[model samples]
Target: MAQNHEIANEVLEAVGGRDNIASFAHCATRLRIMVNDKEKIDQNRVENIDKVKGAFFNSGQYQIIFGTGTVNQIYEEMEKMGLDGSSKEEVKSQAKQQGSGFQRAIRTFGDVFVPIIPVLVATGLFMGMRGLLTQPEILALFGMTKETISPNFLLYTQVLTDTAFAFLPALVAWSAFRVFGGSPVLGIILGLMLVNPALPNAYSVADGSAQALRFFDFIPVVGYQGSVIPAFVVGLLGAKLERFLRKRIPEALDLILTPFLTLLIMITLGLFAIGPIFHSLEEVVLNATTAVLNLPYGIAGIVIGGLHQIVVVTGVHHIFNLLEIQLLERTGANPFNAIITCAMAAQAAACLAVGLKTKDKKLKALALPSSFSAFLGITEPAIFGVNLRYMKPFVMGLIGGAAGGFLASLFHLAGTGMAITVLPGTLLYLNSQLPMYILCNGVAIAVGFVLTWVFGFSDKMLNEMKISGK
Candidate 1:
């Protein structure tokens, strides 16, 4: 522990004392604070704080970088001090008003999707495991083939692989409802209604194997299996409708009538109107995204990989979960995964370069662990504490990511799963493709290290850190 009380005291004062903060939260490597007044902050003083690698305002919060494990302690310290220790939900509601229109929209998208990533990630890993167990070489070693696989094993694998995509809309709707301030239970129920077994599955409809039911002989009703847009829209509409009903429904009847009317009205609207309309729109967006991914040679790789960290900086990278899920649902593999892993590698490598070159003990201490963490598939420590602090390092990371991404795309590389990346991503490429995965990561880290060593760090930065004791 880094003397929580002292660090908390320093953090509290740097953000202009406890009174200036509207709310506080921490992600992997930063203390994100919503301040009542930006004018109160002492940016220079905060950046110079001992153990703080960097500081900046982004996504409507004055974020001070403390690197992974340290942030958790500082956040708890602030709470122990009786400051605005709001839950993530409360902070989200308050912070929504601070960003520009586009920023707010992106934030909302993140709010809705980030919470559900763990669920999908777990499912994705299971799917990858299923694929691995059934690989031709592995099966041959066991004296079995796909046809000879045990039905019991196959059945379990199907559950592991299919369950997530089958109920994806429900997950999205549940998360979206929470983000939009609706009752999460209601959102979940509504999501289930959209994908009920009684209705024709969306995939069956897409494959032209099932006929859609005609509601009132006009509207088409189908299950929203593997769907995102329909559930997301339904969540928004249901939330707004619930808020409206709660206001008009009398206090005595609040519990009963509000639930009754909200569910009845929203479920009906979702099945008849929202599902059909938005499902079409979802298809269009999916097509466009696939077209970009399928673009000639390495353009998509260079663009997506180069700019991916910028998205991380904006805190809107969670939106890519939706895209990656959609890709997995449609293509049965995520081509974006290996490319993203490469980007993460570049970030870690740049941090490692700084760790090697820095003379200041404080800077070296920060960079080494942050770099190691980044290489393990978590980049926030490296990104916020080391690379982004030196503008040139961040740009070098981008170039390295672009180079790695270009090669990944040129080779038509893809991952068997989403979520896991950098070091852990090796499991995804465990089949005969493991060497390729290593090579791609090697390309990324090498370029990032060489470029950053040459251009990102300097004697001057280390001198500043030594003098200021940063």
Candidate 2:
């Protein structure tokens, strides 16, 4: 605890003290600070600070990477020092005030998706495990066949794996509601109503085994299971409707009547109108994404692979999680995972090239570990710390990623899961697919390394390679 405070003090000193801070906040790993004067920042000093994993300025925020729970502790110390910290939402508001519409949209998209990844990731791993357990090779090892496998075991795995997607709307709605300053529980209720048993599961309707419940002979009530857009829209509307109801309801009846009316209206509106319209629209989007990803002869791969890390730099990469999840839900495979891994591996390789080329011990220390981390499926350290600082490396990484993605698409490689990638990505392809996954990542890393070694470093970087003797 004392050590944390000491490290916090180092950060405060490095940033030129409290008066230099315009605002301060932290995300899952980065301590995102907006300062009044970028000129006052001791960039080299901050990067060397104890407990900081990496530091970089991006999106107008000087982000000091502390990694996970440590950032929260550092922020608390800052608060105690009378630095007067701002919440992440406040930081976001300030950013929106400064950014263009497109930037704001990207930020908002990240906000919605960040809180939802863990839910999806856990579900994805479970899905992979279910596939692993049911694989014919594994079954053969256990002296069983698919038909001979225990029905009870399949039911358990299926329930664990499928429930998240089946009830995905509720989870997304709850998260969206919380983000929008609404009652999350109520948002979940509305989502559940959209996917109510009475309305019939979407699959049943698709197979013509079930019909939508007709409301007043015209409006077809339906569930939004496995849907995203409708749940998100409904969450937003539910928040607005709740606030509206609160404004008009008498204080005496507010607690009871406001919630009741809000829930009642939102639930009905969600099922009778929003669910049908938005779910169809969502399908259109999913179909469009599939088409774009399926463009002939690895063309889609070239585009997605080349530009993917650019999106990551903007922190909007989480938006792809939805696409990946939806792809897996619909087709039982995710080719995007293979492409994304390639992109990450490229950056990892770029970091390696930078580490090997730099004479500065400080720079070398930062880059090598970052490269390793990126290989292990976390790329931020490599990206923000090294490759982005040398713009050529970032571009090199992108090109490598494009090459790898093209190969992956041409090979038609797919994964059993969505979230995990890079070196750790082998776990996702346990079904005789690990070799192909390795080949894809190898292409990415080798391309990135060769390109960066040849053309990534600037004359300025080489000139500045001398470290100040401590």
Candidate 3:
């Protein structure tokens, strides 16, 4: 354990003594830093500092990893030292000042969602696999007809899959409220209004009634269950409004009045303004996606196939998620889900290449399992621990990903829903176009593996460098 002041001083000094840092932010476990210049950062100094476990740089941000339960305290200390720890403001300003329109949009989306991705992926996989295991009827469709599919099993699977998604709006509201520096509870209340069944319906109709009573018509609000964007927008507004209301009210009456006015204004605006806009935006996004996916399947495949890893890294992969949820809600089958699986395969192939090329036992040991995990759609271990450490592996993975993407697209293969594991999930796409998606993914991985092995090694060069050092 580090003394509060000691950890604070160490972080300030490591980040170039407060003056060097432009802004700072902390997430669940890491401190996100921005400095005047990257060169001024002292990685070894920070890593050796008490309370900080390690440090690394990625996607233009410096990350200082800390032990469990320490990040919030460290962040509070940083704020006391006058560091601007508002990550949301920093991201919005940066996007406005820099990057193209598309890039800016992507950056904004990433800023809001990236911190929550691990939870989403883990929970998504957990629910997806449970559904596959327990739903014997689903299995029977795949020729596994030995066991009877029980209603209880089906109900349990629904509960498992539905739990995470059912609570997503509240989750988004909670996170976004925190980001905007407001009461998380208030945000949850607003989110619940959108999803909660207890809320009174605006209008009611009775069959064969002489007179119809319509309480509230032209109300554009829809159930926000499984929604991502609406709650985020409403929460952002609520946070700002809460802060403003808090400042105006007397300290004695502050709590009651603040929430009362905040909710009143926020709910009204959410229904009249934000909800409709985002609903339209969602439709726009869907229409645009439909148009793009309607392109020659090969061309669509080539584009998405190639860019999937890049999308994942930047954290815009959630946009692909919108398509999946929309399809599930409306059509019950999503075509783009296969793209993610192929992208994972590409990453795994690259990891395999690195494992084979490296003579270092440590590197090989790390790469082998990472590749296996990536094949199962868990690429963070492989991406951060393996491919990211070496330049060649990342490039190889991207190439392989593109190849697999193209092939999967070429066959117009789609998935029923998202899968936790890419390896077995690929089997889900088995239909008339199964062979095409499979062959494309296999060829892409194999080619990537072989190319990485041939080009990734540097035995002679490494030996020469070692000799020179001696």
Runs with alpha carbons beyond 4 Å of true place in candidate 1: 80-84, 216-218, 464-470
Error of 2 at 88 (Å): 3.8
In candidate 1, position 317 carries an lDDT of 82
Error of 3 at 350 (Å): 2.1
Backbone clashes per model, in order?
0, 0, 0
Decoy 3 TM-score against native: 0.67
> Whole-model lDDT for model 1 versus the true structure?
0.84
Please tell me which model should have the higher lDDT, number 1 or number 3.
1
lDDT of 2 by residue, 376-421 (tens): 8878888877887768899999999998999888887888677778
- For each candidate, what TM-score against the reference? 0.93, 0.90, 0.67
Sort all candidates by TM-score, best to worst: 1, 2, 3
Question: Candidate 2 clashing pairs?
Answer: none
Q: State in Å the error of residue 361, model 2.
A: 1.1
lDDT of 1 by residue, 248-301 (tens): 889999999988998899888898888889888988988888888888978988
Residue-by-residue lDDT tens digits, candidate 3, 384-426: 6556555667777777767777776666667645544377665
* TM-score between model 1 and native: 0.93
